[model samples]
Target: MFEPSRIKNFVFVQKIIKSELMYLQKISLANFKSYEYESYVFSERVNCVVGENGIGKTNLLDAIYFLALTKSSISNQDALSINHEAEYMMIEGSFEIGESGENITPITNNQSLITISIQRGQKKAVLRDKKAYERISEHIGKFPVVMLSPNDTDVIRDGSEERRKFFDGVMAQLDSEYLENLLQYNRLLLQRNSLLKQFSERNYVDDLLLDIYSDPLVEVAVKIHQAREQFVTQFLPLFKKHYATLSDAREEVEMIYESEVGAENFTQIFRKNRPRDLAAQRTTMGIHKDDFAFEINGFTLRKFGSQGQQKSFVIALKLAQFEMLSQQKGFPPILLLDDIFDKLDDRRIQQLITMMVDGTFSQVFITDARPERTRQLLDNLGVEVKYFEIVK
Candidate 1:
């Protein structure tokens, strides 16, 4: 049997193992959710945080989610959830990753910081880091992450909006330029929509609107479409492979992009749809309108899938996303599973844990409602793992 001190030293080494680890280094939260002022240093490999409900287990994951892209996992929520009496919320984290034959400093010395703050009742956002002058896009490709939670099941059970968000978030994290263009495209889309509303009321059209909006809209819309298509193209093979691995079958899985009016000749399509859009008072085409259809055996799984199938598909999608990010971006994104065991049976859970431990993930953060179940499953693994219990 291993000595207690030896085990303690081993855990300490694992916590700071910057080499060969391409995942989360640490996470710091301030006035964010239930965490008034808390920071957690992560094991470069596998880390677990256990807590009772409402103790901020999911909130911890949300903090990382926010740090990655400055957005929440769920869109409909208050921005000022830092604390009841707080004026702003903040989250900071570091990543130990390598890119293009160069290691990204390897979490040595002080961590590279990512700070996000939202002032009370402010719609705009602000981001800063070690240096005062830094563009938000610079943080991309540094520390990439992917999240899996109960809400992921909504991609299958709910409307297409959630699924679209799933794709957009993944793609955005991988390609920062795509994200920049997407933001520009969206701003123009909103302005055009507002103008369309005015046009419907017979308001005058400024000549600059076409020059200012249409050209950039077309250019940015094309870039967004290309990035999404490339992501989907690269994502599908691994996605299907993971599905087969998870289900232990070759049940064919398919993902098709559905776009309203800009499937071909994006610029011409936008121009052609302009009159109808003005009449409808909404910009009804482009990347914002695209959706992914997860089909199995030539039938749409969103409607026809059994509960087990849906869960397996979601897990496979997440794993495939992780793989794609690893291959294209040179580091696997961090994986977080929230009470996933509750939705899966022992056999499925065993299969998932096996994949997780067998190099499928670089670093994993898991939460289980029942510690007994989590402990029992983890005990079967031979690799090093850390467990922390959160009370209150």
Candidate 2:
């Protein structure tokens, strides 16, 4: 049973987790869209960002996401959101992380200040011990984080890109090499598709086309397929276990990696589809055509599940992601819930609080339209959670 007040008690009861978050430290925003000048410093544990709709609650989290991923959470909407007077924008933050070095001892009171800034579409980040960088990537990974916003429920309702991005982004936080590989693969994919389209126009000879385009595309496609399959294999069980916990075994969930190309015999599939590919002017059979089919019992959620069931499923996927990242990287990711409580019933809300109140997450940031309703729920958990109100 997760007792809310026990969060503070849990902190006192257990040895201090140095790798766990110490605090948010401080945030400085300038000319960053709606947040012309905004600053915030967070509690060492749980800090909730509360406000009415359109008052910059989501924007605050968007700033954090931008720092972490180097991209805005709300994609195309960014250009319009940029402040009128600001040619380029910036958001800066400083924080602390546990020590890592030749010291064999545990990280007791071990921490360092980190500084990160995003300006002119470039990210300048560093983690320092008063003066020098302990490690740059260390700052990014050491403070592993995850954000679950209202928009995330679309993972169940939207295209495969959303679901794939969820996995890739989480994996990117833990594996820098994978991030590099994914970027390289995507770049090659775009070039190869362009060449293939040109080939259909009779602009390139067959041997030349095969030499320049086919082999490299297959190689990258195979690597991506294998990596995604391996990740999904390990991740699906964790997802199922979490779903069971949240839904109390009321639903059985399944995930199938559906790919039009890049199977074990993907070469044959590509060759067989070449005539059609030439007509379509693109190589359509590959990991790019893959989708994850999420099903409950025998019915597919995309076509059959009710809105409530779909939300529960997506939340379970997020919780599973949190656990997987923790297991992979040796610490739980910070959980962000933005307006998730809106349509949830009390029972489901209680279940969610049960998971978090015990400090399962190193830290959490949540937002809502009704601050008092959220505050009352937290009060029931007996936790001294912090809250902030955003004003336009």
Best TM-score among the predictions, by candidate number: 1
Q: What's the TM-score of each model vs. the native?
A: 0.85, 0.84
TM-score of 1: 0.85
Report the C-alpha lDDT of model 1 over 197-239, residue by residue, as the tens digit: 8877876556466557777877787787777777888888878
Clashes of 1: 1
Error of 1 at 278 (Å): 1.8
Worst 10 residues of 1 by lDDT: 6-15
Q: Over the stretch 67-102, how does candidate 2's per-residue lDDT look in tens digits?
A: 555457777444544567775566666545453222
Model 1 regions more than 4 Å off? 1-19, 75-78, 98-110, 122-129, 202-208, 260-266
Provide the clash count, candidate 2.
5
| Model 2 TM | 0.84
Local distance difference test scores for all models: 0.70, 0.67
Candidate 2: C-alpha RMSD to true structure equals 5.0
